[model samples]
Structure formats: C-alpha cells, structure tokens
Target chain A: MTWNSWFSHGAPTAGFTGGPSIVSRNNAVCNIYVRGGDNALWQKAFFNGAWHPWGRHNDGAVLASEPALGSMGPNHEHIFVRGTDGAVWSKAWNGAGGWSGWFSHAAPVAGLTGGPAIVSRNNTVCNIYVRGGDNALWQRAFFNGSWHPWGRHNDGAVLASEPALGSMGANHEHVFVRGTDGAVWSKAWNGAGGWSGWFSHGAPAGGMIGGPTIVSRNSGVCNIYVRGTDNALWQKAYFDGSWHAWGRHDDGAVLASEPALGSMGPSHEHVFVRGTDSAVWSKAWSLVPTVILHLKVLTNPTSFTVDQMVASMRDVYASRGINVAVGSRETLDLPLLTDVDVSTCIMGTTTAEQNQLFANRNGVGANHVVAYFVRSTNPPGNGCAAHPAGRPGCVVSSTSSSWTLGHEIGHVLGLPHVSPSDRLMMGNGTWNITNPPPDLIDTERATMDTSPLTVNI
Target chain B: MPVTMRDVRAVLDPDEVDYSAGARLGPEAFDYLLALVRDTDPGLAAKAAYLAGVIRGERSEEVVAAAAASEDALVRVAAASAAALLAPASASRVLNDLVVDQDSGVQKLALRSVPADPSPELRSRVREVSAGAAEPGLRAMADNVLRGLH
Candidate 1:
C-alpha cells in the first residue's frame, strides 16, 4: 500500500497519552509509543513506507513512562519503556536478528513519574536519563554489555521534567533537564573525565513546564528548546563558552511538545516541534558572511580607510540587525583576526581561491572580517590582483567565497540553518551568488529562517 | 463513615452545582441523585440529567437513559452523551431520532454521542443519517461520529 494509504489507516487515536520521545533513525524508520485505553503500551512503527501494527503489549503491567528508541548497533535498534513498577525495561530488534525478549534493568527510581530520554552515540553504547524520586536528574548508561551508573545522581530543584541527551563525542554526552524553579540545567560526561557537576544556566525566559530537547551541532555546541509554562515555545543555547538568552519565544494555541533537532547541512541545523495545533513547524539558520567594504590604495593608503568602511558596513548591518566589529592591530588582538582569516581562507588556485583573496583583503574572514585597502595603483600580482574600481562598483571583494562566512557568522551570532530561498546566506555556487537573498535580513534585521541561538541548559 | 445521601444532596446547590465534584460521586451518592431524576421537582430532572452527563462509567446508564427520554429537550440532549458511552445499543435509537431533532443543540450532541468503536450497523446508520440529514450541523456531526468509529 502507498504510505499515505497506510498512514490513513493507522492515524493516531485521540486521547492516546503520548509525551514520549519520537525518534527517526538514519534508515527513515520512526518509532513511537502511546498509552492505549487499557494503559498498556501501544507501539507503532513506520518502515518501508508503511506503519506497522498498533501492537498492544501488556508485559504483565501498565506503562506510565514514555518510551525511548535508539540504535542498538549497526542494522539494529532498541526501545526502552518504564514499567509501572518504575523499572527500566528494554526490547530490541536486529535486521536479521529478529526481536529479542524484553529485559528489565534496575529502576532509576522507585516511582518513575516522567519519561526517560535515551540516546546512543555509537553502536554499542546507549544512555538514558530520568527524573528521580527526589526530583534530581538520574542517568544510567549501557556500555561494554552492562549498565553502569555514572556517579552520585545530580539534584535538580523540584519536579524535574524529562531529560534530553545530546552527544558531545563518541563517548561524551550532555544531559539537559528543567529544574523545579523553572530554569533549565545541564550535566556532562567527557569519557575520561567522567560526569561533570550540574550547572544551572538560568531560568528560560518562559518557565519550563514540559520536557526539553537537546541537539548538538558538534562536540562543543548544542541547543535546547522547551515548552514554557504558558505553553509557548522557548529556547536556550550553549555556544562557544557562554549561554545565550532564552529568547526566540513562540506562543501557540495548544500545548507545545518537545522539539526535535536535525542537521540539514554543515553548520546548518533545523529544529522541529509539534505546535499547539498538532501541526509540525520548523525554524532553521545557516551561517553567512557579513561584507566589510575596505578600500585598497596600492601607493598611499588613507587613515580610517578600513574604519570608515567598517563603520558604513556596521550601520548597514545594524539597521538590519547584523552586528559587525572593526579590527584593530595595536594589541596582539591581530592574532585573533589572523586566526579567523587563516581558518576561513580557501586553499586553491580556482575562482573560489581568488574570491578568498578578495575576501581576505576586504576583512571578511571565517566568522568576522578585517578589510585592507591600498591606493598605490600597483596591486600584488597573481592572486592579489585588485579588481578594477568601476567593475562591480564594490572594490575589495573579501566577502565569503561560498557565503560560508555569512553562514558561519549567522551561526556565530545565533541563527540555525534554514532553507536556501528563506536563508539569509544561501551559499555561493549552490545558488545565485551575485547578491544576498531578499529574505537575508528580516524586519528585525536578524535572519528569520534560522533557529535563534540560546545556551542549551 | 461513608458519605451519606444527605451530605451529597447538601453539597449540590440547585443553582450552582460543581460538575467536577459531581464526577466523584460514588454509587450510593449517585443513586440518591438518580432518585432526584425521578422526583416530582419541576426542573429537577433536567438538573439530574446534566449531572449524569458528566459522571461517566457503566452504572449510570439507567438514569441517563431515562433522562435522554425526558420531555424536556435540554435534559434529553445532555443525557444523550452519557447514554452513548454507557449503553450504546439502547442510546442508538434515541440518538438516531435526535439527529433530526428540531433543536440544533440536541442534534449536535446526538452527533457527538456516537461511540468511538461503533458496530458496523450503527456506523452505517450514522453515515446514512449524516448523508441525508437536513441540518448542516447534524450532518457534520454525523460525519465526525462516523469517522470516530473507524
């Protein structure tokens, strides 16, 4: 049967309790569990363009905790659901391995109140985090064929909500949970260093009333989105070394569900949430370069030549909500500027390389720019040859070659990747590169298509 | 001591009864209320019907059915839902007749009162009534009720 036909038959039943984590795997398979009328865990899976049976499993008792699904190994997957007894139980299926019998693990707490978030970074290791009886954040990891307790369970204020997990590395992961005080808090495990002490980032702008979702862009950066007390969507992000605002709030008609984050491209990520109306809504941002107009004078350069250009660009960007910084060489701060340039500079003799040279001369680097201008009428030969003054009207062309600078800078400021047409920085060569997309600067001057960056707590 | 019928009646103010608390009434307290439905009080039957509509489960079917068949239209509409959940088979006939009831509110409730898992015969009945019903609201409710069956 067609996918649409199959889905129509297995459409969700109203009043089926489901605060469970729904996950889609690499193979395009999605797994979710809803509480059936009998309170048994009812399972439904989407595979081969069809939904499987709404299997009702009694398993000797009712299930109050939400079920979590993650990869067990290559070509295999596992599902964990908490029994009414508050014990963690697991079920698994391997491609040619068939289904395994359910197995129970030690309970995280005697009275499991909320669902557990499970994530697997690799084939053999999986981690599950739960809110404990004392309202603390508790976790258990299945590694080397057995479940290992990380350390003394960390405490969250009161009524800890569901904890979401994001991987930092193969063996490292971070857990985010909402505290009783309505703020979001986090803990991390860095393999050799073990689990870190709990840290509170501060209350989300809207108080956390539901579970939070965490998605990592890379090892050091992650974002968390949660439903506020008013049922609006709120976010917190962790980037570089600091936590950003709990901004990017969206109020919907119904209670919002925990968000799901997916990577759309390098440095581009999208977050999806079930809105109050039960329709899926998403926001994304991709990095893009900010152009700095530095005039080059080969023979004799004018003072503030770079400063005037930076000031103009800053004004233009500020009016649009894009912030720009002027580079200074008085201190060793030049190294910071150099590091950005060296890392962002392209390594090739192609047109892209030439664009990188122009970009470097104009002050646009990986995440920022430092434009340089000379009026000697004698430009450096080869790659550094200056474009004629009246060619495109804008002399130093040191913006990003593929719009990578814009996209990266967009991310640095706080936007997640979005679709090309709606993106502020549609990378060059992939689409038209002559000018920025019309939607590049939203009314707020901030890129509207991308998810706003906030510290993930 | 068990909550007495007098205590239940005392808490239920005629003009402003709490439906949330009414939902927690036990079998004995419910029986006392059911007795009121049969009382000679002028609007007492309608009030009893409204209370019965929100108090779910199987035991309230008899009183709910009596209320659904009451001479008062509002009481009949409120009892239709309780009847549908408690005794779908018996409520089927009244609900079907109410599909074309002159009161739009009664017809609307009748439409929503269909069971989620109705018998095929009842489903066909709903489809036929909804497809041929004159009132747009009733027809829409009939269509929705049919969908719920599936």
Candidate 2:
C-alpha cells in the first residue's frame, strides 16, 4: 500500500541510504536528520502534522554522520553531529531557546563516519558512542559536567552499519553493531568498569544488509533487528546470554526502511518498519514474565525510592499501555536473582553481588537471569571528590543519575553505541535525564520480540 | 523421505535456497506443498505462504485461494500477495473481499496486490473505496491504485 502519510519527510532517494537516525521524544515530537543534497547535516522535526524545513549545519564543514537528539533537561534538547573534521560537535535548544550555536568536543581517534545515536539517561549525564576510523567502537561520556576520554576503543571487524544503543542498568549500557562477518556483535560497560571486550552472538541465518536497531526493556536483556540480504527483515536477540536463531517474517513486502520500535505495554513491545512499497508494517509479542520484570528494573533504577523518577518513567511507559509499578524497596519483594536471566551481565561493580543475591533466592536453573546494581557516585550535596568512585557515585548526583542509569541499563540489554559522541546509550550525544524518546521503547521492544530466542533443541 | 514442511522451516536461510528446486516438484507437487499452509503453527503457515509465492502453475491458484480465505490475517495478506504474482485475475477477485477486510493490515496488502492496470469497473470500485474507506492506510492505498490506472 502507498504510505504517503508515513512519508513525513525527505523525498525518495535513489540509493537505499537516507537519514539513519529517527527519534521521537514522547511520541509528540520527532527529529530526523539526513544527508541532504549538499551532503551536509540536514534535519526536519515533526511538530503538529508538518515536517519543518531542512535545517542545515551552517558552521560545520560537512557532517560525517547522522545527527542524534536527546533532551538535555526538562525543557531542553540537544543535537550532536560529527563534522568532516572528524570531531564531534553539539547544539542545544531548551524550549525557551532555539538551536544554540554549535560546540565542539575532543575528537575521538580521528575519522568518524555515520550519524551518532543519543539517549538521555538523565538531564545532565549522557554518553556518546561512535565507530572510529578503525571501525572500532569508541565512547565519550558527559560525567561531572565534562566529557570523559573516549573509552578503550575496540574493533568489531568491519563496521558497515552505524551502532545502536540501549540502557542496561543504572550505570551500564550495551552497544550493538553488524560485524564484518555479517554477524551481530555486542559490548557493554558497568559503572565500575570500562567496556567489556567484544563478543559475537552468532551469524544471523540470513545475510544482514543494514545496520541494526536496539532498545532495552530492562538491564541485561535486549532484542536486535536488521534487514537481511534478501531485503527481508531478520532478527537476533540476547536473552539469558545465548543468541537466538534468526526469525523471518512473511509480511508480504520487502523491508527497505530502518525499523522503529515502541512499547505497546510493560510486557509487550512492537517494531515498525517501512515495507518495500513504503507501507509501515509492525509486529509485536508479549515478553516472557522474567524478561518483563527484569526490564522494569533497568528502565527505572529508582523504581523503589525515587517517586518522581518512577512517575516520569511510568508516564512514558503508561502512554504506551505498559504497566509499571513504583514503590520502595522495602515494600516490594524483588524477584530472586536466579529466577531471572543473567547471561548478559557486564563485568565489574555489584553485578556479581546482585547476581549472587538473585541466585541465592532462586536456584541454578535461574542462570538465565541477568541482574544490575543501581549505585550512584554522587549523593546529594557531595562534591565531585566525595562522589562515589571519585566520580559521581551511582546515587551521588541526580545530574547524570537517570541518564547514566539509562545508559548503563542499555548494556544489560543488548544495544551498543551508535555514534562515538552521540549519547550514552548509542554513544552519539550528551545524556539528559528526561523521559526517553517514545519510539526508543518501541524500537527496543520490537527488536526483542523479533530477535531470535534460543529454543531448547 | 518426502520434502516435509519441517525441512523447509529448518533451512537456515530460505532466501538463499533455489525456488526452482521447488518448481521441479511440478504443479501438483506444489499444490500438495501449498496445502501445508493450513498448519496450525503460525510460523509454519507464514513460511508456507512465503514459499507458495515462488511456485508457478494453475495449481498454485488453488493454494492461493485457500490462503486468501484463511482466518489468520498474516496468512491472508501473504496469500493475497502471492496470488497477485501468479494469477492476477483470481487475485483481483480475492483482493476485492480483502480491500474491505476488517484489519487495516489485510486491506493494505489487498490494495497493493490489485493490478496496476485495472478495468474501468475495477477503477471505479477503487475510487469508491478510496473516498469511503475509514482507515487512513486503506484509503491512501485505494487512492494510489486508482491513481496508477489513469
């Protein structure tokens, strides 16, 4: 079917290439930045029904990748794009203000290509991840009001597609990309450590032809989806540690567009992609019970004591028909660790402790469970030095608190950094602790549902 | 052993397999093969419908007919498109019923399968649906089909 309504921006192009990043904040607002006729970073934002003009970057020589957007705070959002100079730069708009002038960040190891992906864990804290010239994943985070060194970069063989990120825990995140071998690979970081070494899930049954998209329902669990060589949609998921087989769909059309996902409910997530005919098609499934419970923890690190944070997360989840529970740790009986899936835990921090607690409560059969600790470095009123870990402890400052949680949780799930300086989850831009873009939920959920889950042979 | 439907599903990547191998099974073999669409498993049914799209012959018509009338929207959409590829005439008739199908998804597939070149009657019918269809997706598709005819 003709999808005129869905063609919200950009006329058809000859190449399969278009803007790789499309994000919707609260579903009411969306920004899609593309490589324009001039090869500059061109953007269009959706407000009301119409798409705004093709806003070009005036200062940068040329954008090397797609622009990533995330809220800097309650009323402000930031856009990060890579320049031809191989340095990452940013611009912000805090509702009261329009797009601010561009600001540059310390360039990661040179030659960055592809648009960055940004996700705000909280208002002040964010991380940007990108693939360097070496085709290795590199990251820079906004911690204590400054950008950190691009974390130890590692290669994933060939990097033809951009990366996608998702929150894994309060201080953990995951990055996913298509390896040179055409298989999906992942790496993650916990608050107490740097990125873990790269790990290959397995080759997708079908040849992957496009970059993957990721979203996390909770820490340590995520689903990934990509277009196959035949132009059909293919998926692989990380649940309880092992990668599942690739699942294919017969949706009656070849999939040519990047898939977007949103939450249908707390236990349900859906993915949407443009068919070859340009029609938007979607598929959804209910997550298993253990997966649902685990996702809640990652999405809401403060689900126990932080009423405001929980409320905000709940509002976003509820808008998508997701059921969420917010209360204190004392009031709720957290599920035993063993009963949960633990295959995708990142090394370091309280992950071992949390996993141990879970296992003690459950049993060996609960090895599939994945658990993450929501510690903060900066407690209220503590200066940077007093902040836990000599940085802001997990609970230290509310600044990067939520955003960091979102970023870390992304790792526990299955996403990877999309841009080196984009956002924490995708490693493209700065982190803002506002509600995540609504489509982020959809993208993650859809990827998870469609991703291959290992079946007992 | 006969090529069971399970064998087809077990194929790591069907996109890499040669559709001509199935074609060698002949029309009757294909028809018997298409009957597998009625399998209870949604994944299996989905796979069968996908494979049916590659079969060529009159018996393929019967397979498409059965799939078109399926209760499953996924199967119906798949069947509608598969039918359009091989039997445009019969496909059009099936697509008409689907054009008004309850699910916006089915209607979408039906609109897509409708022949690009339509008889005047079909053109008029598409126009009517284009103007009256409630769902935005279906209305747009109907309008598009009618627009292409001119």
lDDT of model 2, residue A221? 56
| TM-score: model 1, chain A | 0.57
- Sliding window of 10 residues with minimal summed lDDT for model 2 chain A: A378-387
Supply candidate 2's per-residue lDDT for A188: 76
Per-residue lDDT over B39-126 for candidate 1, one digit per residue giving the tens place of the 0 to 100 score? 6541345445555655665557667767666665545555654455455565665465555556555565566677676556657777
Whole-model Cα lDDT of every candidate shown, in order:
0.52, 0.51
lDDT of 2 by residue, A127-227 (tens): 78777766766678886888777763644345656677776566777777877777777777776796687777655565777677776655555778777
Q: Candidate 2: misplaced stretches above 4 Å? A: A1-17, A40-61, A72-74, A154-161, A217-221, A238-243, A257-457, B1-150
**Tens digit per residue, CA lDDT, model 1, A1-457:** 0001001223234334544344455445655555554666666665787657666665654666656767655467676777776677787778787768788765654445566668887777888767766676666778888888633363434546767787867887787776766677778888799878778877665466666777775667777877666666566777877778886554333445666554433365555545544444455554543332233322122222434434444544444544454433221112111101111122222232224334344332332222333211001100122221211112222211223223333433444434354344332121233344324556324332232321111
Chain A only TM-scores, each candidate in turn:
0.57, 0.51
Candidate 2 TM-score on chain B: 0.76
